[model samples]
Target: MTNADKKILKRLKKEDKKALTELYDSYWEILFLSSYNILKEREVCEEIIQDVFIDLWHNRAKLQIKISLKAYLYACTRYKVFAQIRKQKAIKVELFDDLKKRFQYTNPETKMMDKELVYQIEKTISTLPKKCRIVYKLSRNRQMSHKEIAEKLSISTKTVENHIGNALRVLKKSLGYTFSILFL
Candidate 1:
């Protein structure tokens, strides 16, 4: 690590706010660009950068750095970017499902086709690993919050999010965009 970074880390560990400001000034642009390159959303990138720093400060006292500060910050930014992507995807999926529910299929042919699609979706969901299937059904069918599902299943919220993401990916791949979005 550079002498400059070592100094920053020392002050940060001491809960010095100026040290945080210095770190932010030095790394914000690079970190913002790193996240933006993946997410392509300026405001979201800014929020992710802010979150990284906030978390850094929150955990600063016990923080352990086996790598340079820059590398650690970059890793945190990348992780937050991926999480934002997953959150956005989940929102899109929920929006599509909501819209589908609001539109009733009145015609017999349309209703029959909808039933077939739903059946296929169910079949694909059943193919998921047991824990994943349970997590997914709780989230979708029961409309359980991640926290609720985690508590009910005795798992962490992050694990619940991962299972839902995995289920969506598999369903989207097996059923294609139109079917998966509508039925999933």
Candidate 2:
């Protein structure tokens, strides 16, 4: 979180409407677009974003931002998306395996492409700065909040956020598309 983010958060904790509005304005489109891209359901994505904001405002008093606000909102939106997926009665292991088999057999070309893409992502991650790679891995693989990462590493949250931001920028440039879909 930047100093401005911290100030807004502090104001939000005090139940300031303007702070909430600022947060909502800054993040609404980002939340909507990311959720929509993954879920492919515009109405549900909009609802999810709205629900996230409502929850954020309602729980502002007790909020412990272990991540940047944007990251936190993204996590919340992701959880809601997965929750909706689960609610649709999709068995995780079976559904994933089924999807993989469907893709692998139906399109050998696509399967090869997928493999190459995964390899490229792995290679890119490996080339990141040591601390940036660590931060990225912790956030994506361990699902740790930035605050938790900072605390565990005895660093500031801003450093963790910076590392993540830098890593994402690098990955985005390397991938030539939306890297946030897989990580971030």
Candidate 3:
């Protein structure tokens, strides 16, 4: 850590507004640029940078940064940008999937069957191994895409797909012939 950053962090830990302002002034532009480079959204980048500082201020007393303040700020910006990307991807996927499902099963009986299928799938997911269950929940319940689940859980997309496959195999075995409807 630089001498200046160390001093600033020390004052920040003590709730010094001047230190917080200094930190913001020193890092905000760099952080914003870093995020903008990835997300390419002006307002989103601005909000992300603001969130980084807000988080820093809120957790100032417990800050345990092991890197330089600049690196830490950059890391935070990158993480926020990735999270925003994942959120956007998930929302888009969810919307598209919802539209498809809505059009596919409009009748009352099909709707009831849909509900039961979802319940059975969820029940089966609950019986999976910890990682597999989490992956399945994030993919099915949260409507996150495989890529989003992988990024959020810090795993490979292939790993996410594998986990989903494992969960599905379990579901198929447990639900028997009824599970075959999902493929159709």
Best by lDDT: 1
lDDT of 3 by residue, 1-184 (tens): 6787688879988999998888889878766655555556799989998988888788788676544565556556555665686688745544344442542244443344345545555677788999999998898768799999999999999999999898877765654432122221
How many clashing residue pairs, candidate 1?
Answer: 0
Q: Rate the local accuracy (lDDT) of all candidates.
A: 0.73, 0.71, 0.68
lDDT of 1 by residue, 20-121 (tens): 998899889877766665567799999999998998898788665534576557556655765686788645554345433322242343344345555666
Off-target runs (Cα >4 Å) in candidate 3 are 90-184
Best by TM-score: 2
- Candidate 3 residue-wise lDDT at 54: 88
Task: Show the lowest summed lDDT stretch of 10 residues, model 1.
Answer: 101-110
The reply for model 2, stretches above 4 Å from the true place, is 90-184
lDDT of 2 by residue, 74-125 (tens): 5566567667777878546654444334433324443443455556667888
User: Least lDDT summed over 10 consecutive residues: which range in candidate 2?
Assistant: 175-184
Q: TM-scores of all models?
A: 0.49, 0.51, 0.49
* Model 1 steric clash pairs: none
